[model samples]
Target chain A: MNPLWDREILMLLGGVVGLLALGTTVGLVLDRRVTSDAGRAVVVNLKARVRSWWVMTAAFAAALATGGVGSVILFGLLSFIALREFITLTPTRRADHRTLFWAFFVFVPIQYILVYREWYGLFAIFIPVYAFLFVPVRSALAGDTEDFLARTAKIQWGLMIAVYCVSHAPALLMLQIPGYDGEGAKLLLYLVIVVQLSDVLQYVFGKTLGRRRILPKVSPNKTWEGTLGGIGTATLIGALLWWATPFSPWAAAAIALLINLAGFAGGVCLSAIKRDLGVKDFGTLIEGHGGVLDRIDSLCFAAPLFFHVVRYFYT
Target chain B: MSLETLAAGALTALTRLVTGVRARWPDEAPSTSPRVYFANHSSHLDTLVIWASLPATLRARTRPVAASDYWDRPGLRRWLALRVLRALPVDRSDGCGKREALRRLIEALDQGDSLILFPEGTRGDGAAIGELRSGLYHVARERPEAALVPVFLENLSRILPKGEFLPVPLIGRVTFGAPIRLGTDETRQAFLQRARAALIDLRNR
Candidate 1:
């Protein structure tokens, strides 16, 4: 755990670099080929997204290099920022101020600290059971009953999505799978790679072959054709990367497919929230990809289920 | 970078991290000319956010007019305000003469550095902005050539509110509106109203 520079880690980083090179090549080709205004805009955004991917990949690689401690801190910051973005969109009043303070300063840190300490019993139910009850009662004490139900629910939901679900990705470090040494980091890496790859494929397939919308009301860019193509490619790739995880090839495919579907649902649900808020993106952090929340919406949606799946079967 | 710039850079980073700021400039863009960037104040963070939100080049030239009572204390707070932030402290307490405060602000503008002012004089209750004091009008009137830019800061009060030590990270939007000038015959009431309206107009945009 102190120094983890294994061949498997190197291979994963190398594969990511290879993908970056390929992505750059495709970007160059798109730049020369696309003539229409819409095509040029898409290409520009694609290039920006790719550029952001390089930064994100580099950050992720650095985090993985530090082993479990690094990954936990990384995801903890993500939860902090993601929760901020979520709460920023929701309406809260003066009574919610101290409540929000406790949410950020107290609850968020304690939740991640439990993960860092490898307390599985507390990590699993801390947010859902304890914080769930604590938040409303805390707000109720403030005595501002105006929108009490809505305010409490919004804070709870913010903690659930931003803190609970997202933290599960890092909590992968705590999984004690039988016959699988200390390669839980690899599993986290695999899950991230699969989800991200699926997202890219879905976008690629949607832009090229997409015609029928999956649910135009929920998400316009998403389509039946793109979803299938993304799942297909991602599952195939996930199966190939089974050596990195503690799963069989076919099992990897099933898990990748499961993550992709869950990620897709997550993306759609987040998009609905964005529409309700009447904004196109969550924040202007990433050049063209939007905020950290926007980039990890799929991961947040998929992490809990994926963690539980691997924990239940492999561990 | 020197120690000051390095500390300022760190401060700016922390401010941006806490306030997910999205800065929008006027179509005419901010000029290097001596100008007063005024806004509605709510939290202590208002000065930091406005200062941090400026473009890098302009940031060096713009000094926020902070309340001397809060920023001019001993040790770290004063060091941060005077050295790192380069704030122009105007004694906000009642005992300190307004004439002395006005003299220092005018002196700053005369030295060719732009100033950020909260003409409301003090922080409000986070409602609609209270009446703007005549400090800004006097500045505008005194330096007739200087542009008066109305800057609107939203959600900053929520990010770091009154009496709160730890700041909750919240997205704050800064809208810098067009530059206004003091009309030749304009009264103080009319001038402040026009400037206030311009700043509030930024909220919708």
Candidate 2:
């Protein structure tokens, strides 16, 4: 059976649509009820985010419907945009131009191509090993030693987070788990749904009941209540969807917990970077979610760990 | 659509894809009225990126003031400049050419077409905005009715800086500040200083 139309995958997508519909309805109610200027502002932002979520879900579903290749290309393009946003915020001198050109044009395509080919060994090591060495060498050859280490490290970090980490989501398709043969798409969807749901739940919880700040300096919006509530709910959801994955209910819950923690770390780490860069959001690409980087920061941290866990245990 | 329109559309799309060029109008939404969009010159892509960031309605009437010596070569470059971009070629060679270029720029403004002008007159090192040339002052002086809009093109130099051809795919920001106009008794030097300051202001923001 085609994984695209598999019962579990369709059921998962239906759940997402239902969740979005509920969100839209709730947003409409809030918009109508919230009369104060500050409350109205929050409602407006909520509506924009919900609108973007609908578009994002449709795009994600379309990509999944096309099978592995579509997801690969879609993630590839997302990586490209995320990397562009990452580098745009990082200060790179004219000396690093060639290295950046190589990063964007050569290394990005080659990495995605390796993923498409399902050559996991190379896909896993290409950016971390080869591109890692190449970036500094190319920058050194450019002869601008000023901030050389910092510059090279930044470019490498950008590629790692924006390309490498994000690529792991699609690389999930390459995992050859026993009995999960054509269902790699479901695992990919599972990872995304859990990670993003944690984020959304955190935001919802934080807005309604959050009192104490988790990391106020790094990310003011995060709170302990929100984090715990979000992780607990999303993990329960993930566990309930164990039929979509190779893992058992308990195993799925454990993995969901791990993914949620990693995603929270990723969000905080990226928010710290933004604070250091002295900007609110990375870029204004997404309507209310900030840039592609902003939307996928959690995925960047969650994907690699989730992929490796599934690969190691299930495969 | 004509081949010119098709090429223009492709170029704009390609520019957006490659650079993810984002436009931010801080003061007012983009209007269709005649205006002079002046920006810091850095990479060769600056003009196209700014032109592409404008709304299609404004883009159709907006012509970039490009150097003929560079873009007037007989081939693809010329075709892209004249046919696709519909650039207003400015001769930067001699005094007579300078006068003719100013006349042509004013003529384009008189015809009610918006213009994208790089007032530095040449590409900078991308680190800082170079001193403003008098051409922007002169053009604004002649066409007082047209808005003198200061635009700041950021990170384009890093994407495709001076002397490099292969462009790295980095997001480029095009910021359009509140429009300024030449005061009735403002001196050319003062107006030029103010214009340069306006671009610097956008950069800092």
Candidate 3:
């Protein structure tokens, strides 16, 4: 059986709740102090973001408490909603209908089920091998060849990223690291906590000191000042939280650095796609986050890389 | 809620979840005074989606007009149409003529029940709204007081296309436009064209 309880996990969760409370307090104070139209707008958005953080933190803490099953179900649901948002924007025609149905109902659920069953061998290749082959063959049977290759490719890509890649985070629950044993919960929490904090820190630093844009053509909000500030701050935090994991403080920082870089790459790529599609947000499900996809954009990119890295050296 | 009510509630929730349905009505609030919501026919999911998306207060009073040949057939199809949707099944090929079908609709409106209708009379390829069938025109004439709400359904065609049971999970939206009443001086062609235009206009917004 997995050891789900640890003092470090509790303290970490408490630290998050406390920081969110502090941010909310600061936002409320700034609400009265701010002047000018731009300042007022920024204050209002900051308050909304802080409010969303409180609710999101509470939900995440509850899921973490229930151990692996809770985390698996939570991430599984994220993949489903993320995939839904991905397909919603793509230009799918009439001929792709049945094939898409299979993707959502059959493929998405099956990939998650593989993670649940801990069939790592099959889980690794289900989307890339099985789904990749199945999507095109089934679509061809419909006999509509106009944009046939493009249509099948879009569906396959959606599964690969949304379903397959995202699943690896929860699939962290399946990692059998020698002495680390069933402590996959800590590993997942570390990845999520480090990645999310990096995003928030990047925004904060960017607002205060960022002047140079990293990629203005893709996402103007991302700046070099923000990226460097976020990476440095988050890596330090990851190093400090090393007691919960099997890694040394140095190893934790190294992995955190890798996660942040991967997260940045994910954010840039997803931002480009959203711009291409001409939409600001994926859905209105999350208040400040825009959509589930918007919130998990970083996770989608970083999860596979982090999982493989941990599985390689530790397992 | 009773067992039947529970089932209906579950089905409604499930339908909304499967289709990320975003419904936006015009700023002017929809009139609760027994109105006819006539939308375009695309896939089998059309009626269920429109019906599911309605406010619960209006939903109880509304009955979707479904084809008897398709909906009233035996097995799960009939159960869903009769039990879940509580549809008003109109005989598409009435041996006694179209008046009987028209009479039943008017009677439902007379009894203070709102209705969900498809003016196209049949499913289309979801390209342009097909030429408005005369059934809607006649209904507007009979119940001139009932608001003829033009509902534009977008993206459902790709979600469940014609003749496919399995549905893709795509974001679908239902826009309910402002209602217009039939003018006494307006001819059938003019009224139908105006209604068709109303529905098409709701598409972009």
Candidate 4:
């Protein structure tokens, strides 16, 4: 009964070893044989990933640096970048220029500042109430009536996608749950890890063994085998990491299932948005990562649900 | 040597490389001597993109004019404006002060530096071209020797916009219009109208 020798931790360790072995073997095989343009894309993707191992390692090191709050801030900056990419693709008018400016400069700062200040009440209402009112008022003052409704709605949509959805990452600080005395932030990290891992795993599994397309138009990369296997594997990892969360290993598995499922849907939906916008990636800030939005599409859906689940069950 | 300009140049080059940069000028031979380069503003990054697109020799002799209030905010901005890009500031609010600022601009032309001006005076949404302000006409009137070149900026409004903190990776196109000579019989309104027409004409072409 060693404190560190819990069944959960042991299970996660085994899973991690299994994933690394599987991913590396397939990646190496693909690297050797890729010839066509599509095949070359896969090969390049694999090689780039292998080269970025240090960057990934650095990311983990930085995540563990400031304990949990520092990790939260790191993810917060990521969400800000992702949200900025989302709205930049969407068309806006001169009438909404001032409001859009405030959205970027004022609102974004206020939302993050609230999280930094630990002002939960304000953060909760900042977007739904304050943003809703402020945007229309600013638009009305512009005095441009042509397409006023469309203009105002566009502004709101930008806030919803960029601020409201992305802010949930930092909202992890507000969770006050029993059983996990001070491990609430750790639980937040666990959820993000599980969700992002699910995404990466699905891609790996799909690329290596995919023959049947899950939904070709919405997300050509997704596959049935990847969906089922990725979620199952991620759940096993989540079940093993239950110590970080207030839930039992079984409950942790269930939560992981929900996160993976929702995250998959999010990725598909955002990809569709990109397709409709007549673009590929949201932005080129991240090399090989497409855009910030491309990276965080899953988080937009998973963060809020994860936050609420912990709040409901543990708090 | 200034950090902001150096960083801004690097960022702009990176953005252009990833997003596929294209520039089109209205006329084949752009006069290298003294010309007013006017463009539509959509993002703060607009200045860097236009500046970077210029050839080295022209870039060395070109000065981008920015607002004094914004450029004067911090040491970094000031250094970038004063030292790196060598920008001349024109006060948008104060009429008399703006007149004095025009003198400085004239001085830059006298010093053999071409000028870049954002005619909209502020950032606009990426939807369509905004109304051209009359400031360009004033500059044209004062510096008749300076050819007025209308520049149309596309996709920039959508990339960074006015208030968004991060830039969206999108291809931005800059079309530089041919030089428009101000006629002796042209009124201020007529001169501004002709300048706007020149920009619109390039955008269509």
The runs of at least 3 residues in candidate 4 whose Cα sits more than 4 Å from the true structure, single-residue gaps closed, are A1-30, A49-57, B1-45, B52-152, B155-205
TM-score: model 2 vs. ground truth: 0.96
Q: Give the chain A TM-score for each candidate.
A: 0.97, 0.99, 0.97, 0.86
Clashing pairs in 4: none
User: lDDT tens string, model 3, B106-140?
Assistant: 99999888889998888999887899888998899
Task: Give the number of the best model, judged by lDDT.
Answer: 2
CAPRI rating of model 3: medium
> Compared with the true structure, what per-residue lDDT tens digits does model 1 show for residues B1-205?
7999999999988888778787889656767788899998988889888889888888888898888777889999999989988888887766556789888889998998999999998887566888898889888888887898888998877887777777778899888989999999999999989998998888788
- Candidate 1 lDDT over A1-315, as tens digits, reads 443667887898799889988998999998999999998999999999999999999989889888988999999998988898888888887778888999999999999999989899999999999999999988889889999999999999999999999999989988888886777888888899999999999999999999999889878899999999998999899889988888888998899889988999899999998898787887778898988899999999999999999989987
Sort by TM-score, top down from the best: 2, 1, 3, 4
Which ten residues in a row are the worst by lDDT in model 4 chain B? B11-20
lDDT per residue for candidate 4 within B1-205, as digits (tens), equals 7675576577557756633456776575556788788987878878877877777678777889999889966777787776777788778895688779878988888888898998878887655567778778777787776777778777776666777666544456788877787788899888777777777777677
Pick by lDDT: 3 or 4, better one? 3
Candidate 3 off by > 4 Å: A1-3, A31-44, B1-4, B74-84, B94-96
Runs of candidate 2 with Cα error greater than 4 angstroms are A1-3
User: Per-residue lDDT for A263-285 in model 2, tens only?
Assistant: 99999999999999999998887
| Angstrom error at residue A144, model 3 | 0.7
lDDT of 1 at B176: 90
Q: Which one is best on TM-score?
A: 2
Chain B alone, candidate 4, TM-score of 0.89
